[model samples]
Target: MAESDSDSGNLAQVRHVVLVLSGKGGVGKSTMTTELALALRHAGKKVGILDVDLCGPSIPRMLSVGRPEVHQCDGGWVPIYTDSEQTLALMSIGFMLENPDDAVVWRGPKKTALIGQFVTDVAWGELDVLLVDTPPGTSDEHLAVVEKLKKKHHVDGAVLITTPQAVSTGDVRREITFCKKTGIRILGIVENMSGFVCPHCSECSNIFSQGGGEELAKLTASPFLGRVPLDPQLATSLEQGQDFVRLFPHSATYSSITTITQTLLRSLEAA
Candidate 1:
């Protein structure tokens, strides 16, 4: 027999709430968040992806959800899922706007209100994990979510992403500081764009000056999750709204990402 409808409509009991963030832009934080969600789902866990990058949302494009069908029920709003059918409860402003390019211009208070609705009003349904894809930088939106989540719920932990660069690592350090002040525990660090692998020679090259994130994790005493090498195919796959984890499970980059997912699961399980 099929499961009950109520079982698929609420996520308050989700075991883990993971915030995927980066210190800077262009570090593939969004991509990492999506892939990690897909990875967890592939591992037999129900997951949700919340793109809180209000001003520059990307989950819709990455997941090919396009504009979602919004509806009002009771006193709150309900978020729509994607056509990919990953069983993910996806929420993003892109789903509400007539066009994905519409701008979200609001101050801190207003932003906070919108996020409140994003959290309280939307029907998240059931989930094993809720992956929040925050915007780059430590902006008002980022702070609001952190503050709100901390006040409202016991967040499982954070999965910080960073590329292999000094500037990127520096920003990530500040993120660590913020997390410290907010009492959020660091789950681990995933070093994205760690290097590039040559198809011809099967050799790895330090395209973004490797190991910056690993070095920072060492400095901060956080676990170095794993390294995701740069893959040209991944860019194309993400653009086409495909789950790289499912589509390229045997690829080197996907294997590394899977390792990071395992680290996360292990920590959660032990906790």
Candidate 2:
């Protein structure tokens, strides 16, 4: 049997894999990953999140699964189920860390090895989607993940995240190039924190420049997913590990995310 065939045993039950990527940090990349996973869960899909941001694994805190012990079974490592129904599961380097505050100071090869293990070892059983939350920039970790997933399992595509600033969108251009070079399909570009919506009058103010993400998508001929405005309620829900999508159904942020999720689901179905 081929190596890919042998390695396929781990992720054989997973239907689709999506990578959530961004060009720079502090742009809510991991937050987008968590929100997307939750949105998918609300859509009644079994979802798994592989947090590959070794140096800064914040998914655990974001999901409120703090420092849960990871165990290994006969198949492989068992991922932590975030919900009672077990529809949402997650595996992250944060759980393995002795101290969450300690910085992960490691070279490229070690990170690559860990990413490879994450790609092949976690027992993500029968998932409709597995979202790989990556660190910022097109670096060794990105390459390691893309190579392992493409060689062993199928990576459906990547959802690129960006802020509305030129600096952030400029970095995303490099990410677009990186995806093209690696032959990973660009599912769409999401403009996160596009603007801030007032809670009182509900007026949207562009504190940051807007439409850079859409402009980039048009320039590259990639699908423009949607813009997620900056909403305090959304941030509070994420910080408190609450289901914002379900709780704040009438909020603009919830609508934007739901629409984006629908667009992503449609794209996946069409594919």
Against the reference, the lDDT scores of all candidates come to 0.81, 0.91
TM-score of 1: 0.91
- Model 2 spans > 4 angstroms off: 1-6
| lDDT of candidate 1 over 135-217, digit per residue (tens) | 88888888888766655455777889998889999999998987888788899998898888776675779866988999999
- In candidate 2, position 177 carries an lDDT of 96
- Number of the top lDDT candidate: 2
Counted clashes in each candidate structure: 4, 0
lDDT of 2 by residue, 162-258 (tens): 9999999999999999999998889999999999989887788999889999999999999999999999888888888788887888888888999
Model 1: worst 10 consecutive residues (lDDT sum): 1-10
